[model samples]
Target: MKTVVITGAASGMGLSATKLFLAKGWKVMMADFNQEAGKKTADELATRYSKKQVAFHKTNVADSSSVKELKNATAKFFGVADSIINNAGIFTKGALHEVSEENWDRIMAVDVKSIYLMTKYFVPDMIKQKAGTIVNTASISGLTGDYNMAAYNAAKGAVVNLVRAMA
Candidate 1:
């Protein structure tokens, strides 16, 4: 079975995608910041599928160290991921004046920089194997400005450009 790694796998798009991949018979490594939720989801999947088909790794996608550890653990568990879904993200709703520096930085780090970090650690394995795919989840707000969500718009806009550049 192909191995897939998904970040923010605890909920929303990430969670939905995880279920879809598992249903398709792919081995999945569910990575998320919420240890409890991540483990819970993994346990449920294990019960439905085989325990061997699912695993959870707690990760802070924005942190280089955490992401590196995720890479190491995933490699140990299932070898290099055949596909990586860089889907971890946060949304902040506010105009520029109302947005804090901390919020802006947080959103940018998680939504934008995580892609670079994931690719940095995972792409080499893909290159060695001569195959791989990277799917980046960007918001429609990234393509056009959204009301009262300046930081989100900015960060996701960067995501769009980054994906374009990667392509």
Candidate 2:
């Protein structure tokens, strides 16, 4: 069976995708920073689908070591990944002048660096296998600026361009 690895798989779009993929008969490796949510989602999926088709790995995509471990774990669990969805992100809202450096860095780390880290580790495996797909989730806020969300908008804009660069 084909396997798909989805980051941020504990909630929102990532979680929804996990369910859809399982329903369609794909082995899904759910990666999320929230261990409780990730484990819960995995258990729920396993119960609904079957234990053989779902697995969960606690992952914090902003950290390089964590992303590397996630890649290794997924490879060990499923042999290879046919696709990856980089969907982990965090948003911070404030005026550009009012945004603290800490908040800026945090947003950039989660919303932008996470994608880079995931690609750094996973793309090599994908290339070696000679077949793979990657999907990155970016918001309209990234495409068009929004009030009081300068930092988030900038980070997500970076994501949009990064996806284009990867493509």
Report every candidate's CA lDDT: 0.95, 0.91
**C-alpha RMSD in Å of predicted model 1 compared with the true structure:** 0.7
User: Candidate 2 clash total?
Assistant: 0
lDDT of 2 by residue, 1-167 (tens): 89999999999999999999998999999999999999997998899998889999999898999999999999888878899999988888789999999999988998899988888888887899899999998999889999999998999899899988999
Give the poorly placed runs of model 2, Cα more than 4 Å off.
none
lDDT of 1 by residue, 53-138 (tens): 99999999999999999999999998889999999999998999999889989999999999999999999999999999999999
Q: How many pairs collide in each candidate, listed in order?
A: 0, 0
The lDDT leader among the candidates is: 1
Against the true structure, candidate 2 has what lDDT?
A: 0.91
Candidate 1 global CA lDDT score: 0.95
Best by TM-score: 1
Which lDDT value does model 1 have at 130?
A: 100
Model 1 quality (TM-score)? 0.98
